[model samples]
Target chain A: MNAAVLLINVMALAGILVAFMDDREKAILSIKIAFKGFMQILPVTLIILIVIALFLGFVSPENLSGFIGQQSGLGGILLIGVAGAIMHIPAILSFPLAASLLEKGISYTAVAALITTLTMIGTVTLPLEIRQLGKKFALLRNGISFVIAIVIALIVGVAMEATLWQ
Target chain B: MAISSQISNQQNLKDWISFGIVLLIAFVFLKIYPSKTGSVIEYFWQYTMEMVLILPAVMLIMGLFSVYVSNNMIEKYLGKYAGIKGMFLSFFLGSLPTGPLYVAFPIASHLLEKGARVSNVIIFLSAWACLKIPQELMEFQFLGWKFMFLRLFFTVILVIIMAKIIEYFFEITDDRL
Candidate 1:
């Protein structure tokens, strides 16, 4: 198996072993929870996978780069950054999706911005966040997160470009 | 609580509908471009295999974390205090395998009520949202070590800065309130 698969399997094995040693009932309960969580996310995962396939199969690297490649400039970065802030998906799944976008000639900076904001800002969860943490706190956290996500992405883009070019 | 549950239920419905639409589109794409369908299926299969390998383990880690690390326990530890220690603790606790970012909001609110610094609470919330261990591992798997570590480092630094900025703004707003 590849390292990623091996690592994940080992992690699952270790988690099960630890839980079993700690409490058999809770261990079993954890497994049930895992299964439920998987089921809940499966539909979304399939949809995203299908979309990614379409994205890769149809969209050419040049076309993608024209929108968000190395020279796509600040506007392109901002656009994807906003898209990331607004779109809510499970963060773990975002990496693969982002990688696919990168493979299609989207700039690394754009992908970074997308992943950062996608994880940090949750437009869908804003109501729950405001309800729990107060309006100002929720708004500030998300708004600031968006700006920082862009900044972080640009930095990564520049750094990566420098290294890759060298 | 009722509103959140209602929202989540709506979200679930929306997701199902979207999935249905996506499936329909996939079918159409296959029919229209029989030759391209091979590439689409290939990409789909690759991602599906990767996801099948990782997602279950990720979910199990999250499940074990939720069961073992009670929110009450987190509240007791991160509720109050200030300074570098509190900020670091917030980042550390937030990075643990607990639940999603929404769940962290309640914990953060509790911490605020218990007199935790706003900066620390922001740190905690952001860390919980972005820096969970299992999520990092998945990112590592897909994005490579350079991307993963660089993004992580940048996020940590920027999160702190953002927290401090928000804290300052809130303090000004607090006086007015």
Candidate 2:
């Protein structure tokens, strides 16, 4: 396997072993929690995977690039930023999807905005957040997050092009 | 608690329904474009393999931390540490393997009840939402270190600023918590 996979496996192995050594009961509970968490995310994972596959398979690079490509400009970034905030897919899967789009010539700014907003803002879960933390805090947090995501993406895109690509 | 459980149940039902709809769409697409099925399946398999290897381990780490590290522990750290130290500690604690943002909301409310600093609470909530360790690892694996690190650095800085601004606003407006 690749280094990422290898390192993760080792980390998990070490964590499991340590937990088992420390407390058998807790270790068992951890395993149960792991299983429960796995099941919880499974459907979403499958959905994201299939959707990504279809998206990449069908959407031609020209079409993909034309919309979010390097020259697609600010409107494209705004479109994606809104989409990211609204969509509630697990953030982990977003990286690969972002990478795929980047490879397809989508601007780094757009992808960065997508990832930042995807993680930072959750329109779908706003009700739960408001109920838990009050409307003011929830609205303020998410609203600020959306604005910052765009700023971060713009800065990142410029920095990457200047330093990394050069 | 009854209401919370009901909300979770409804959430679960929505998830399964969305899953079914996505699966149906995929099936329809496959049937319509038999020629592209191979490429679609190939992409699906590639992502599945990556996630199958990494996701469970990530979840296990999250579970271990969640089960072992109590809310009391979080409150103690975030409550005691003050100023810049407290802010850093809030970020650190929030970055640790934990549950989703919703899970952090209740914890944040509890911290507010215990009189945690508004800035620190905001940092805690923001970090819990985005800067999670496992989430970072996944980003690193897919998007490369440069992408991950740059985004992370920018996020940390902006989140701190945003938190402070929001806290100031809250202080001036309502003196809320």
TM-score of each: 0.95, 0.94
lDDT of 1 by residue, A1-166 (tens): 5787688779888989989998999999988888766766777788889999998998888877778887889999999998988887878778889989988878889999999999999998898888788888889889999999999999988877785744
Q: What is the lDDT of residue A114 in candidate 2?
A: 98
Error of 1 at B100 (Å): 3.0
RMSD (CA, Å), candidate 1 to true, equals 1.9
CAPRI accuracy category, model 2: medium
How well is each residue in B1-177 modelled by candidate 1, as lDDT tens digits?
A: 355456556767788899999999989988998999889989989888888888888889878877787778778878754688888888988988455578677678778887788888889888898899888888888887788888899999999999889889978767311
Go through the candidates in order and give each one's DockQ: 0.74, 0.72
The window of 10 residues in a row where model 2 chain B has the poorest summed lDDT is: B1-10
lDDT of each: 0.84, 0.84
Per-model TM-score (chain A alone): 0.94, 0.92
Error of 1 at A116 (Å): 0.4
Per-model clash counts, in order, read: 0, 0
